[model samples]
Target: MTGDFRYRLERGGVKYACPACRQQRRFVRYVDTLTGEQVADEVGRCDREDSCGYHLRPSEYFRQTGTKPPTAAARRKEPMPEPEPSSIDAETAGRSLTGYGHNNFALWLCSVFGEEIAFRLVDAYHVGTSRHWPGASIFWQQDVTGKIRGGKIMLYDAVTGRRVKEPFNHVTWVHKALKIELYHLRQCLFGEHLLAADPVKPVAVVESEKTAIVAAGFMPEYIWTATAGKGNLKVVKLGLLRGREVTLFPDLGAFEKWKAAVDQMPGVRVSDVLERRASEEDRVAGLDLADFILREQAINV
Candidate 1:
């Protein structure tokens, strides 16, 4: 409407709206051999690029002519759906598929732990399929005797009512057992243990149950639990750190993701866990603390 406006070509039939005032002018229709009769352009200009400082591209005629793009308020992506209750509630029961725990896994767990220890078959699906363990095994620890006579790795599968298959591979079975045991401990003892470990102080957090176990084995000074995944950091108890320090020792692989999230917590301090001299001699390096411990024992023997 003012001298500050000039006509410019946008597209064929689409009207040009001022980038600033958004005032639109009627566009003339035109026909092209290729596109046929189409509003291929808009003619308009703003002398106010200095004061108003906004320009519209001829290609924007599609938008100007068709319909305005949704406002920024509307264009934003929907917030990621809140982590579902199933994911957040580790205690919630999951679907039990029949295929899980179809093998004779009790024999396998007893071999790893001991017959004297309370060992039994559990549904792998119902109890919660092991993220790391292939089949399943008892979830407990042992004493110095390399036996579960005093300790029990109790595995309760969330899926089937029966025991799962035993591993054909010895090394694989051992590794699977350890993994199952670690996760079992986390599912069973972690919340209570970590809370009690230091009722009055902040706790150290690790990413893996084995890591937490190994660290606790060496230094009973701090409380710890692995949230399973880096993204699961929110599951760590903020209440435990009401007015204390939270040292985190994420596995080497998860350091960066862990660090970024750890600092977001109010009083979390990132730290490291040093394996004992035995660990070094055993050439052990992995996310699972059980691996570290087993390697140490093997190397020592």
Candidate 2:
């Protein structure tokens, strides 16, 4: 019997009330592949972005219920194959650092934080420009051990510093773009390489690479890093933070999602700054830490 491991919307085409808001047709439930059953009634997401944002992953459900989901070995009749470790050599990582003239994000950073600080941030994070699209920047995910795992390429508006998602949702990975076959890509936290630079500084994590850079510029006290996305905050990727003080500054709509995920993680704390201070308008706009910092900077100026 061949089976695949994935999650799909429960009862396709049927409307289900959201667990959080009770809104109909927005809820999507996770279905267990092995048992051919819904894992949990509330283990899914609500599509409503503004009013109701509820997403409970299978992993979160398992953690909450104190139950272990079926392992790969158990799920498949055949023996599970081990995945190979993927790596980007130092040379490739070095080559990416060469072109900063067309790096719009870097140029924008230079304007906001000034040349010295912006150059430092770029060098520290291995921020690169891609000829793939003019003004496209690469946020390389270098591991704590100084290995280049991969890079996430994204296009941003130079003046606004906002990501350009329309006309294609401009995002791609270095590994995929290079067509590195058999490369088992495993992404670590963005800016993770900074951990090796300062063993004493407490780590502050956000959801976007832009936020990390901006936050780091304003508050040099804490080492700022990003998960790259809310869902990418996995326990495995956080292993390097074992004994270190770690704080999560999730985006406005992501506080609960991150809080629940890190409950069992020792030495990890979630910041409630945005949750406590944000107005309904800010929440609706999906404001993040970077937005907060910029607002304060503008006020002080």
Per-residue alpha-carbon lDDT of candidate 1 for residues 185-286, written as tens digits (9 for 90 to 100): 212223223364345654666664434544444454555455544466765656646677767766545567777875667877764443333254444433
Q: Each model's TM-score?
A: 0.37, 0.71
Error of 1 at 200 (Å): 2.5
Q: With candidate 2 superimposed using the best TM-score fit, by how many Å does residue 84's alpha carbon deviate from the native?
A: 3.2
State which candidate has the highest lDDT.
2
Give the RMSD in angstroms, all C-alphas superposed, for model 2. Answer: 18.0
The CA lDDT at 297 in model 2 is 53
Q: How accurate is candidate 2 locally (lDDT)?
A: 0.82
Clashing pairs in 2: none
Tell me the lDDT of model 2 at 166: 89
Please give the distance, in angstroms, between residue 127's alpha carbon in candidate 1 and its true position after superposition. 8.0
TM value for model 2: 0.71
Candidate 2 C-alpha lDDT tens digits along 28-135 = 888886656777888887989777778888777888899877776766765667675588888886788967778889988988989999999999889988877888
